[model samples]
Target: MKFLKQFGIILGVSFIGEVLKYFIPLPIPASIYGLVIMLLLLSVKIVSVEQVKDTGSYLIEIMPVMFIPAAVGLITMWSELKSLWFPLCVITVVTTVIVMAAAGRVTQFIIRMEKRQKE
Candidate 1:
């Protein structure tokens, strides 16, 4: 029952994301919109972490299983991917590094802000 409620809330937020994506001119994906909405809601105390924690944790635990289909698709496209492997690898590495750096900087900034607030 609790899982169902949490899952429903998540789905409702995702539905709003889909609606926004349909009406908006931006190129961002619906899933990203949904994530941003979820974050905003949590930040504003409109949604408590405790409400979604169980379901969210469960989904994370099963996330690898969700990648199986994508992995299989990649394997099936091995020949095509091989031809584009160099560019694909370069893009992946570049994006990964950029994201890591951005996340690290954001984390450091947030920690510094929190420490300053405490003092």
Candidate 2:
């Protein structure tokens, strides 16, 4: 019933994203594109939050499980990782800092733009 409807919406959005990914030559992940599409739909009131809340919550609850395979793959690469540990750590830390800084700047810019529009 309601659950099936929500599942159908999620599946439909994901399928459309996959189709676009195959046709588009973007570097971003298809799931991210799907998320963007979903967000746009929600923002435009084409899809109500109530319609997707259950499915969204269920996905969020199971998010940790999605990382298990990636974690296992990393574990299997431990030996190779150990050899490059120092460089990997440096790169990871540097990239994280850069990403954080960039995100903060983008957020500030967006907020300022919104404020200007309001004023």
Candidate 3:
């Protein structure tokens, strides 16, 4: 019952995201919007972390299972993807490096801020 309530909150946020997507012209995904909404709600104390923490942790634990269908789809589309494999690989590596660098910088900045606050 508690998990259901938390999951319901998540679904409500996602539904709001979908509605925003319908009205907005941007190509962004509803999932991203929902994530942002969830973050804001938690940060602002509009939604307590404890309310969703357990359910969220459970979902995260099973996240790898979510990729199974994507993996299968890739396998099924191997013939088409084979022709663009080189370019795809290059793009993947480049984007991965960029994301890693950006994340590292962000984490460093946050750590510095926390240290300064403690000093």
Candidate 4:
């Protein structure tokens, strides 16, 4: 029953996001909007973390399964992707390196701030 309630909350929020997407002209995806709403609810204490933590963790645990369909789709589209392979590889590698560098810098900055606060 608790799981059901938590799942209901998540689905309700996601439905609101979908509705917003339909009524609004913005290009953002429904999932992103749902996440933002969830974040806001948690931050404002409108929804406690304990209320959703179990369901969220369960979802996370099954997330890898969610990618299976996309992976299969990619496999089916391999012939079409074959010609663009080199460019795709280059872009992936470049973006990954850039993201890693940015994340590292942000982590370092955060650690420095924490150390300063302790002093």
Candidate 5:
């Protein structure tokens, strides 16, 4: 019953996100809106961590299973992807390096800020 309630809360938030996404003109996905709403709710203590922790943890544990369909879809399109594989790989590697560099810079900035605060 507790799990059901937690799951219901999540789904309710997601449904609100979907409604917002439908009305808004932005290109953002419903899931992103749902996540932001969930974060805000959790941050404000409107939704306690204890309320959702168990179900959230369970969802996280099974997250990889969620990607299986996407993997299979990609595999089904392999022939089309094969022609662009080289360029796709190059783009993936380049973007990954760029993201890593950006993340490192952000981390360093945050660390510096923390150090300044401590002094």
Candidate 6:
């Protein structure tokens, strides 16, 4: 009943997004486009929060489960992964460190700018 209604809204928005993708040449993912559309609808009060809250929460709860198949596929390809493990490890570590450092610097810069603005 309630679940069906919420599901219908999600489906309708997703379908609209897919239809829009055909006309738009954006490089972004269609599902992401759908999400932005949904957000815009909520912001404009075109879609009530209560209408989608239950279904949205349910989807969030099951989001991790959606990755199970991908995980299993990765596991099955473990041997191939092991062959490239060294380069992968190096790239992962270097990228992670670079990203963390950049994020921290950006945060500090933002905070300093805000303080200077306040003064």
Best by TM-score: 3
Better-scoring candidate (lDDT), 2 or 3: 3
lDDT of 1 at 54: 95
TM-score per prediction, in order, is 0.93, 0.84, 0.95, 0.86, 0.88, 0.70
Winning model by lDDT: 1
Q: How many backbone clashes does candidate 5 have?
A: 0
Of candidate 2, the 10-residue stretch with the lowest lDDT total is 26-35
What are the clashing pairs of model 6?
Answer: none
Q: How far is candidate 4 from the true structure (C-alpha RMSD, Å)?
A: 1.9
Candidate lDDT values, in order: 0.97, 0.94, 0.96, 0.97, 0.97, 0.94
Task: Give per-residue CA lDDT, model 3, range 1-119, as digits (tens).
Answer: 99999999999999999998999989999999899999999999999999999999999999999999999999999999999999999999999999999999999999999999999
Q: Kindly report which residue pairs in candidate 5 clash with one another.
A: none
Query: How does model 6 score by TM-score?
Result: 0.70
- The model with the greater TM-score, 5 or 6, is 5
Ranking by lDDT: 1, 4, 5, 3, 6, 2
Model 6 per-residue lDDT tens digits across residues 18-75: 8888889987777988999999999999999999999999999999999999999989
Off by over 4 Å in 2: none
Clashing pairs in model 3, backbone N/Cα/C closer than 3 A: none
Of the two candidates 1 and 5, the one with more favorable lDDT, higher being better, is 1
Ranking by TM-score: 3, 1, 5, 4, 2, 6
For model 5 the local lDDT of residue 41 reads 98
Model 6: residue 16 alpha-carbon error in angstroms: 2.0
Error of 2 at 85 (Å): 1.9
Off by over 4 Å in 5: none
- Model 4 steric clash pairs: none
Clashes of each: 0, 0, 0, 0, 0, 0
- Where does candidate 4 stray beyond 4 Å? 108-119
lDDT of 4 by residue, 1-119 (tens): 99999999999999999998998899999999999999999999999999999999999999999999999999999999999999999999999999999999999999999999999
lDDT of 4 at 78: 100
